[model samples]
Target: MSDWAYSDVVPWWPYVFILLGGWLPTDVWRYIGVVSASRIDETGEAATIARTIATSLVAAVIAQLVFYPSGALADIPTWVRVVALCIGFAAYQLSRRKILAGIFAAEIVIGIWALAPGLG
Candidate 1:
């Protein structure tokens, strides 16, 4: 075996291609968003769809964390995570749906939970 991880290496050009390949897909969409946003109405169906998609993505991430946690979070009990989520959601709603408040509440709960006697 050589000092490299792979037997074959294509050098600089291939690395540049790989970088562009990873960036172009998302970059193209961002440019499209910039162009379309100038004509898109804030209250239109497209805006609603975008908001719904964003909300769904966030919900999916939360679900993933609760159902299949990783790293240090995996050590905490699932019920505790769910309870923290609930408290965060409630605090969010109570604070007129403020995102930061909800995040802070959830983080505080999780931090305390991590400090619990039997937890890590």
Candidate 2:
């Protein structure tokens, strides 16, 4: 086993391991993206495809979190979650597709539901 695996002997080793294992790999891709970003045409077919795929992945994750949630989210009622999602989508559309508006609207619904007596 690595020294990082045994925290008692080397507490700082875990941070080093995280830097090497996690940050370095992701940072390399980010650097590459930044370097190549200027060369990529935003309205090009490749960019459109990439955006579509990214959006699909986000939608899939959101669906998973709403429909098959774990922990605290799972504890909340499914109907409430669905309603929040709908409201959030509506808010996003109404706010000219502002991401933060959608998120805040959803969060507000969840918060109100949590605070309201016997609704959770």
Error of 2 at 66 (Å): 0.8
TM-scores of the candidates are 0.76, 0.84
Q: Extract clashing residue pairs from model 1.
A: none
User: On residues 12-33, what C-alpha lDDT tens digit does candidate 2 reach at each position?
Assistant: 9889999999999999999999
Model 2, clash count?
0
Q: Global CA lDDT of candidate 2, please?
A: 0.95
TM-score of 2: 0.84
Task: State each model's CA lDDT, in order.
Answer: 0.87, 0.95
Q: How well does candidate 2 match the true structure, expressed as C-alpha RMSD? A: 3.2
TM-score of 1: 0.76
Q: In candidate 2, how many Å is residue 65 off?
A: 1.0
The number of the candidate with the highest lDDT is: 2
